[model samples]
Target: MTTSAILMYVDVWIVLCFYGYLLKIKKRIGFQLGMNISIVMGGMAALLSGVLLITQFPFHFTVITMISTVAGLTVGAVFGLLFDYQTFVTGLTNGIIIGLMSPMIGTVIERPTMFIIFLHGFFIFSLLTIFHSIKRS
Candidate 1:
């Protein structure tokens, strides 16, 4: 598969794992609600980013990424608080981390060395999962 396809798969896996973890912890919440909220926030971010990229707005990629990250976090946090206040912090934190890291990592791996991009995703995902698992215990 192409690098882009692999990255997309990884993104889907990350979202699924995150949603599953949230559902397991917030048993009172509906899985569909959590998934829909995540998808909506993600979609909005993508749309905004695409517009900025295509328009070649004044700001560079870094600035655009930062704006999108903040936007995603704000939206997710608001949705979380409205839906299930208990998961707001978790969702906001996860959104911020994903937002900030994803763009920076993408920029770094835009060169010929694509393995670094996969490594970046793998390491971040692994570290977060391990940290959360340990925290639960």
Candidate 2:
């Protein structure tokens, strides 16, 4: 398939898998860790979605921003729900702030393909770190 389609699929797949994995370990984590996880997941997912969507639909800036923001907030809220109310709110707030800004970044960046590559690496790195922390505790 095309690059945008591949990136979109990768985004959806990673988030879904991550959500499933979180469900398995929710009982073991505390608010602190939960908040961090939500923050990282929501922010990265929003950013990536915004970039991917913008690259695919260059003319629809506002619509893409809204879509990405909702995606981030939903992902964050779900992740945070596994822990506590406080965690949920924390995640929701972070997701909103980052979501609002993510589209702007997507619009300005000159080299999206390279940026997407680096972002996926960073996102995976963060997820691995969270997984390691969970394993330790």
**What is the lDDT of every predicted structure here?**
0.51, 0.85
Please give, for residues 1-137, the per-residue lDDT of candidate 1 as tens digits: 55444544565465456545654555544644554454444433443332333233333766767765775576557546544554466557656765665454444443423454444455465547544543554
* TM-score on alpha carbons, each prediction: 0.41, 0.95
lDDT of 2 at 93: 79
- Residue 92's lDDT in candidate 1: 74
Q: Residues 2-104, candidate 2, lDDT per residue (tens digit)?
A: 7987978978898899889889878888789889998888788788888888888888999988988898888888888888888888778778888888888
Candidate whose lDDT is highest: 2
Candidate 2 overall lDDT versus native: 0.85
Best by TM-score: 2
